[model samples]
Target: MRSPQLRDATSPTGCALTATTALARLPALAPCLPEFSDIVPWPRRRGCRADAVVGWGQRPTTARARQWALRHQLPFIALEEGFLRSWGPAAEGYASHSLVVDHSGIYYDASAPSDLESLIEHGRISPEDELRASGLIARLRHSRLSKVNHAPDIPLPASPRPRVLVVDQTRNDASIVGGLADRQRFHQMLDHALTRHPDADILVKVHPEVIAGRRQGHLEHAGRHPRCQLLADDINPWALFDAVQAVHVVTSQLGFEALLAGLPVTCHGLPFYAGWGLTTDHLRCPRRHRRASLPRLFAAAYLHYSRYANPYTGAPSTLEDTLDLLEDQQRHIDAGRGHWRCHGLSRWKQRFVGDFLGPKACVSHHSQGRFEPSAVATSTERQLLWGSQIPAATGVSRMEDGFLRSVGLGIDLVRPLSLVIDRCGIHYDPGRPSELERLIAHGRFSPRELARAARLIQQLRQHKLSKYNPHHEPSRLPELPGNRPRLLVVGQVESDASVRLGAGRIRTNAQLLREVRRTRPDAFIVYRPHPDVMAGVRQGAQVSSDDWDRLVADVDITTLIDRVDEVHTMTSLTGFEALIRERRVVTYGMPFYAGWGLTQDHVPAPDRRGRKISLEQLVVAALIRYPRYVDPCSRQLINVETAVQLLASARQNPPELTLFQRLYRLTRRYLHGPY
Candidate 1:
């Protein structure tokens, strides 16, 4: 987020823009628009000049861009920030993820046919986009995402009186003038709302810009009405929708959002979404002849009409990418809104855990001896003990390492990009039903979620990404003695929580190896120790030369899993990764994936996890739906797909640790003996 005042047209993503500096001046819009340099004519022109003229909706600079297009006799494109912009208003420096680049007219203006309107009227939407639209809409509602997503999600008035919402817009907003409305329309809209819902109290919603003191709204005086209450705070629109019975608007985008939320909407002004039979529009457009479904309109407006950027990277992106990014942003921000008292995390883990908790969070580390009862000074503060540490009390939550963890070994002090904060229980522990187990049992596998999981699986296979994707490979595994079903015995730190809690009777690598040798005496067994154990930084079970044919050292986990015919694990994540790669997994202990029909289990799964789930379900719950990931490139909260993509990219190798950092890691590992 660079200062908008910077003259260069390049965006924060470091890509050149699609519009001239006149339009790309707002750094926030640069992602949507990708290589414009010369709105400010240089004394001498240099590189390639912009081919087509572009401008944002109705700005003073846009008027100049339009004049330039007219003088040059070229087509002028109108670009407006798309419906799902960012967490907050543009004025607040939150950048835009989506932008509507219209060749005809902008989407907000109903005075003429915009591309969105044309698409709604006569454009064809493919069945795929329609289905995608339904999924996107469902996610939008589920996420409670409105155009600007940074608003505080607070509960609206809980009075028994049915609430009728009145959405107010900035005075003389371009949509107001273009959609055939004026200041008087706000008054009329309010009066109509009062008349139509006499029993309902009016909840007047103010524009974000108005609340910021940067702009004025048409209904600023509406608070004078005894029944009308001004909602001056930047409240989350979807949350507000939940409390309101119906919404009334004069060209405010909240009307469109209300429709998306399945609330009855009355549009007093002819905005682009109005007159499409979706909303009860008092003002209609003859050009909008065809009735529109919510998905159709959303597809036309979001999928077909708008362009998006991989907010983390400057590359062109899809609507789904934006949804994931925004959802993570909200989750991070909302979590940070609370006070956190964290206990039992190693010194190396403190900074990375803070990243998942979000920036605004107030977090204090409480090592065993350092924790004081009164340290939780505020009544509002919450405690999150390390997951798998049986808590003495109930109010605290649990935090653990997520499945798609990081690029380097966690023992090497490589901060993880993903983590799980479970209020229910840690996923690895099947001693009792964890949150992940409950999701496996009760969660429905929608087609959209399953498809996403399927893609993630493909990516994981293509990228060869495992929890800690270190760049090490052992010499080619010794050619199997007879190609007799080869078995891989993956070892873990004996003291690790997963082993202690999840490994039931087979609690140690020594036990796991003995069990495998006894069960399959004929098979050639390859034993690989945990990276930390191999590095001599952690305790490991003793291994004998007679236990296996090959004692592998520093081997890549992915390569090891691929080479094996079957995997033997007592609560190691290697078992889970093996399952994802479609290899046979025999779980001696009760790791999260063992109970499902997908793996051969020596121990019975918790009775609560009775529902038979697919690998796709497991992938969705563990990778897509569960963990929180931060993009290493941007250090911003990101989706699993983006995380995997970043890890897979050849250019995304993590920087070499500074000498001081290396020494620090070495000193800490030796002094503390690994976390």
Candidate 2:
């Protein structure tokens, strides 16, 4: 007998998929239980009585076994994909897959009592649980329920055309067979879609599995039509949903996802999500006849009905844990999946990030146009573009990271802010609305979320946290002659991508400072140049003391901010930090934090930032909810509390540099010349 490090527990019906998970969660099954596969035939051929039976719900095979289990007076545990968002592909139920292993009745079965709705009424959910649920919803909207690819956008025709999408499912799935649908075939759904929406352009999208050729779908053999087009592109499902006016489905998960994405869904089947008054349903189930809001439905399905295991530890986890795991998984897959040549990275920088990033992925330093462009484009998985802007490469996906930098505190040598990892691109570039901005602008913050945001804001304020560490001691400011309101003009790199994309009217630091002087001439103006420009790593327009009344350096920014009544900037995070301190802020550009009605705005982000919300709500959505943090020592996924503590400790006691790091610093300084 094996030591049981990996358990192979089975149910009485023996209709279960293989689950290779950690030993900690192995269920208590009979020691003498036979293998699951062996018991599949015995339930139908010979009657056997047992305590319980476990199987995935609604499949043809499992449905029969479940009936047998009920007939024999045994309890049945129904397994299904957790109705909430998932990190990876949910269709494949392998090890490390998140699931809803429910003991109460399965959600889709109309005849049985529901575990999901009961939890909404009676479950003892905590504040943290609510926070997790809110975070999951935000991620779904921001990343479009995808952990892997964010930029998988397939642009549609530019010609004006109204489009309606009909999402297809695998022919043999349990959802169709067991959900009591009128027609399970994709062709039947297509004909109905064409007839219902005559004026609109109809696009039939097949499941990802069908595209991969792993399984057969109804449209596999159906001849293509001139009016209706079958789409098998690699575009993300969420993107497809966004492009279409409405979505039609028969027991497909896409219908549920489309509803969450705020699309009108017409369902031909009685899936769990349909008949809830949210979607227009052709088939009705009495169980879900009660009307419900999206959030309440999300709470019932995600927080109550499902169980999640930690992606890192394999222990049972929460929604917060799932977010962290998904972020980690996203970073890992992005970094480790494709073979690529990294551009614009120094040898030392490569070594620095590579050690922490592990060796599963390939990283090579090659100058632009040095490698064979054709070979590099075709051979590797994705091109790792290491900069503020993406390269001109046409074909491959771009895995954008901010060149092995951290966002935490103290010297950049030891403690770092968390590494920025984005599948499409980094957050600062306003070329497209970054995920953080999307979350802040569109995400709904509940009362519990607002409370959590309040706590995080308190932490940031008490600790005097800003984007960069305060390397110098707090110095006394020049005393203002009178009590006239003081103004601080924040400066940033003129050539930075954020300025190019977001700094709409006033482009440079000097221009912003001059504008501030013209606007508030009487107010005592203080200008602080960007640290990167001062360090000579980045360039900015010159701003002498003549440009502003006073130019300050070698002093803590917190001290400078304290002496001023107002802070002005063009898309600097400093403006947001000042907002944290409750100071009056005016913006020349639409930074992610701006346009929320919290700051005096000079530009418009009307489409992106129209959802009027509170400052506490913004903090919860951006800091507590959006950003991913990692422990510096353990290199593991961590919560916001742990990240804050690590940064605080780094600020208090700056870590000493090793000899090699010191040498590297010296070499880098000599190579870059003076600031």
TM-score for each of the candidates? 0.85, 0.49
At residue 589, candidate 1 shows an lDDT of 86
Provide the lDDT at 26 for model 1.
49
Per-residue lDDT, model 2, residue 525, is: 87
Write model 2 residue lDDT over 269-319, tens digit each, in one string: 767777668888877665454666666667667666655553322334455
* Pairs in clash, predicted candidate 2: 406-417, 407-417, 407-418, 408-416, 408-417
* Model 2 Cα shift for residue 377 (angstroms): 18
Measured by C-alpha RMSD in angstroms, how accurate is candidate 2?
Answer: 13.2
What's the lDDT for all of these models?
0.77, 0.61
Candidate 2 has what TM-score? 0.49
What local lDDT does model 2 show for residue 674?
Answer: 27
Across 1-675, the per-residue lDDT of candidate 1 in tens digits comes to: 001211223543222223355454444354555554333321212353545666667776667557756776767778787888877665654557777878898877888888888898888887777887887788888989888877788887579898999988887678889999898888999999999989989999886568678899888888899889888887888888999999998888888888889999999999888997888888878788898788898888878787777655555666776776787678767866767888877777786677787656778887856545464544477777777664444556788878888777666677777888887778877766677787788888878678878878888988888988877645654565655888999888888878777777888877788889999998999999888877666767688778887888776788878888999998888898999899999988888888879999999888887778889999988887677787654456777876787777632565566786678667766775646
Q: How far is candidate 1 from the true structure (C-alpha RMSD, Å)?
A: 5.6
